[model samples]
Target: MSTFTLDELVRVLRESAGEEEGVDLEGDILDVPFDDLGYDSLALLNTVIGIQQAVGVTLPDDIVSQELTPRLLLDLVNGHIARPAAGKA
Candidate 1:
């Protein structure tokens, strides 16, 4: 399974946020508040969809309401994305 480290996650977030290159994705992502990440609610939803597309997994329903910090997001994504699908019981 593919796993996104905090660094890769920050890079994707930076791109999704429309940040310019040469900017520090980690520092910038950590510093900016989620509301000021340059994306609106819909845009944030789109970003979530994009992550699902790239990672081949769907996040939980409450993802948007939670995970306001980079570290929290990393944990959520890592934990959920790595979880096994419900089947084969």
Candidate 2:
């Protein structure tokens, strides 16, 4: 299982926000909400899919409903990595 890093979360979130060229996110972004970062539920779902692929974990689609924030994402991914599923999604 691959433990997620804050930096990785930033990059994935930035990409998930639809920055095709990608943005160099820095500083305190963990505290920022996904909506503030320009993402809605649909976009956040996309981001969650990206996280699933990147981290090789089976994540529930409703995770975005829990709150689409960097901090929440980081914590969730860490939890998944710490306890990976027997079968991946």
Candidate 3:
């Protein structure tokens, strides 16, 4: 399983949105959704894809379908790590 951190996710998210300043995401960003952060689904999808590739987590293409919070993303990745689908690495 890959060791992807929430902090790294936040960094990638910020960078993906071309936001380098004034995006205070220091504390519990786990509960914050992408829309609340003023980001669209594309940004969230990009972030999810980046994290999936970085961590090798087998995430579905529509991972942003649900709430799409940091905690949800982490949980999904952890679930995939625990039990990957058959015939899938």
lDDT: the better of candidates 1 and 2: 2
Candidate 2 residue runs with Cα over 4 Å from true position: 20-24, 86-89
Write one digit per residue (lDDT tens) for candidate 3, span 1-89.
55567777777777676453555677667888767766678877787777776767657777686467788877777777778782163
Model 2: how far residue 27 lies from native, Å: 2.8
lDDT of 3 at 57: 62
Q: Give a tens-digit lDDT track for model 1, residues 4-33.
A: 576776556655656644555556565454
lDDT, model 2: 0.73
Better of 1 and 2 by TM-score: 2
TM-scores vs. true structure, each candidate: 0.64, 0.77, 0.76
Compared with the true structure, all predictions reach lDDT values of: 0.60, 0.73, 0.71
Better candidate number, 2 or 3, judged by TM-score = 2
Worst 10 residues of 3 by lDDT: 15-24
What is the descending TM-score order?
Answer: 2, 3, 1
Model 3 error, position 50 (Å): 0.5
- Expressed as tens digits, the lDDT of each residue in 1-89 for candidate 2 is 55799878767766766642333357566767777666788888888888887887888876776346788888877887887762354
Model 1 stretches astray by more than 4 angstroms: 20-24, 86-89
